[model samples]
Target: MKREIENKSKKKVIIKRQDECLRPSIPQFSVFEIIRATNGKLIAGSDDLSVSGVSTDTRTLSRGNLFIAIRGKNFDGHNFINQAIVKGAQAIIVESDFRFDASQGASRINKDNLSLKDCASVSFIRTDDAIGALCNLAAFHRRRFKIPVVGITGSCGKTTTKEMVADVLSAKFNVLKNKGTFNNSIGVSHTLLGLNKEVDIALVEMGTSNFGEIKRLAEIVAPSIGIITNVGYSHLEFFKTIDSICNEKYDLVKNLKHPFIAILNGDDMRLRKKAKTSKDLNLFTFGLKKTCDFTATNIECARGVLEFSLNKKHRFKINVLGRQNAYNVLAAISCGVIFGLNYKDIKNKLSAFIMPSTRISLKKIRGYHVIDDTYNSNPLSLEYAIQTLSEFDTKGKKVFVMGDMLELGKRSVMLHREIAKKIIKSGIDTLITVGPLSHHAADAIKTKKRSNLKVYSCGCTLEARGILLNLLRDDDLVLVKGSRGMRMEEIIEDL
Candidate 1:
């Protein structure tokens, strides 16, 4: 079943892959158990009522479900209490500060007044913070299961590495993973809550834009294993420096259990330095470097697929695009080794790794080979995408449609111009910019006055859409990418 949980930031997390997570065969949770898990108080109903699943949004609540009333910047779940009750929510977890507002559909309950039974014996519980309670209950639920939970965080390839690790683990285990970019506090909680009797292990991707978020997610997940893909220029608006980003990412390793097993990119100098000084974590290094614990050599990308040899003996061929993904693959291979899976099993499962199309995917769209990396963008990811596009053996011209990269704070323009320098050195023939910041890249390119490179600077995607429809030719290789807020995917849709 599809579920959407709106966190405090108003991010609507829509679960796409039902089979991968949120299994129907879940362990049962009673009202009393939730109270213990969340440190919540039973306000008006008996503590004996039980539920098999929990939901934050009333729109996705099912019969016999326990709905947690969440408050967000744009919406509040307490206002939808009547809808959840009418839809057969067995219990409700509301904030302790909530008061009865029948006009707004708020549920009224008190210690002496247990008669508000709009539904059959509905239970009501109160907590200081519903979101914290949700995370706390998820943490409590995670401890009940005895399985290796791998928590991954990095500026790039968090989702890709999560998928690759899940694919490898699935060879010998019933692996569980989050759907889409559900890597924030609420997303990780929902993913942990998806644990059931059937789940052999869980892979939780931790994503953050601010400090302390990764630490909070790590506490909620309590993973046995951890991975940091790499540290780079990502979300600099909240974290103004690379050192701060490194410190934030190290939170995953720091919050992992004592004597933790952390798989990290040895090529990232910060991570390697941290690994050298780590006292609690048993670090495993994976990269193309020969000094790494798990090294990948002989890397190649052909027909938009990555092929590499692990430790120069075991080979891996995956469908994920870009040569940079060899690092992502090596991270998963390290985790597979940690799982005690044989080299042959890891090899057999490597082929099953499918690149999420919304990420760095190469596709034949409208008669052209299109690389739709429109899911999100940062300086590091965008630079690699440009390299992947420029190196691609296409029969026609190479075009890059870049949108504004968000959250860079003061360095947005400088980073954009920096991408322009990279593009100028590459084989790209045409550059089309979608938003204001990327226009800086286009302007930087125009100053060179090179006849071989053509530039189109637009104020928005609507302007770029019309130009691309007429400019694109058959057998062309096009790269469309931008930050999530810019909605760069609209250009590909028009194409």
Candidate 2:
């Protein structure tokens, strides 16, 4: 009887399965069919209909796949349209206003200085909203599956928190989590389209630099449980104010109907107030404060593991760094508790979770400790990373290598300078910075003349790598941090 049910379960996935021959409930449209669907006015006699799947890169283009030529700020996709075709792309999705062929009646410019109208295998579509079309396809694909989706967003800790929640849930559930930072409009759509029907739970992380991004992601996943980790100084450049960012972050809750579960930070006064106006929502909160539903008391961080007592009922231990991560662990525990997992089961599962790559990952290099927190950084996260490093209690001086915290908007100078003061207060002995904004931090640190603190200015990680290698000794501990664009991982490789 169990075997029969298991066999039936395996048939739901749209992707190719080993056991069953299912044609995937999700639609696989040919180039001609998509052109017909979109009413793409081709110049006649274009019959190419090959498609393997959707792709954004020319290098990854496979035979029978429709390559989406998205115009980026730096590069135009129309330039690579021919490359995609040469690499075996059956169809091409191009911008409506894009002039691939300057010649009259030509759909695209070819290497032979001719029109793409002559190519038998290439077909082009002019769409006003290519991203919208992708979103529509992804939404349609997700409707066939009955998966409990969990959407996570916040000013900080969204990725780490999402991973922690997914790991805990995966102990008893077949979980499908979004790949690293794949939480935006295109990223979320791809993640949804990648989902198979057999996945019991879908854990999706939604990130935003500007307004409405979370709304766009939430509409696709429609997560049953929405989690906002905390509101902090992130993406201030896009929104210009904390209130604006708060409003944007709350976009996830705004779209959901009544009877949705919201896991929020009760400690955040702004969020606590916002939770009040949200009607018909079952609100659950986890934090250090006593008012929280899943409060942690008697917290302790020892030997790279955080142990905290949950609501005075159970003591949970998670192998992660910092007190901030302890909050993430508690958030994951609350998720499990809502799903009907007992305290022991939640603790057992959470205990197995390790720190994610590029986010506070610890490695040993010739007996020296290297704390790699170079994943992504904001002012709030940088403080947490600094604090976590200080607690390591190393005999050698504690070192901090930071990079520019992007998207701070008008507050960039103030926040960067403030971090310099924080480095001194945190008792960091050495401070190194990369990029333009971070140079302000390095200057501020030097201005204070706290003889113990050695400040170094490197414009990029390559230059920073030279300083980092020279600073590290046999017993010294180092902490690396920066935003995604800073590429702090390169320095970690050198260390």
Return the TM-score for each candidate structure: 0.91, 0.85
RMSD each, Å = 7.9, 6.2
TM-score of 1: 0.91
Per-residue lDDT of model 1, residues 1-495, tens digit only? 333433212433332222443535765698999999999998766888898788999888898888999999999998887777777888899998886344333334332233355544778889999999999999988877766678999999999999889989899788989998898888888988888878877899999999899999988888878899999999999999999999999998888874377889988989888777778566778887887888878888886778888777777888878888988988888787667677789888888777887797887886888889999999999988998987788888999999999999999999999898899999799999988899999999999888799999999899998888888899998899999999998888877
Residue 418 alpha-carbon offset, candidate 1, angstroms: 1.1
Model 1 CA deviation exceeding 4 Å by range: 1-24, 101-116
Please list all clashing residue pairs in model 2, or write none if there are none: 51-64, 52-64, 52-65
| Cα shift from native, residue 197, model 2 (Å) | 1.7
Question: Candidate 2's residue-wise lDDT over 37-93, tens digit each?
Answer: 545545323555546577778887777677777765787776786677667676777
Q: Please report the candidate that would top lDDT against the real structure.
A: 1
Error of 2 at 147 (Å): 2.5
lDDT of 2 at 350: 82
Off by over 4 Å in 2: 1-27, 30-52, 83-91, 98-124, 446-449
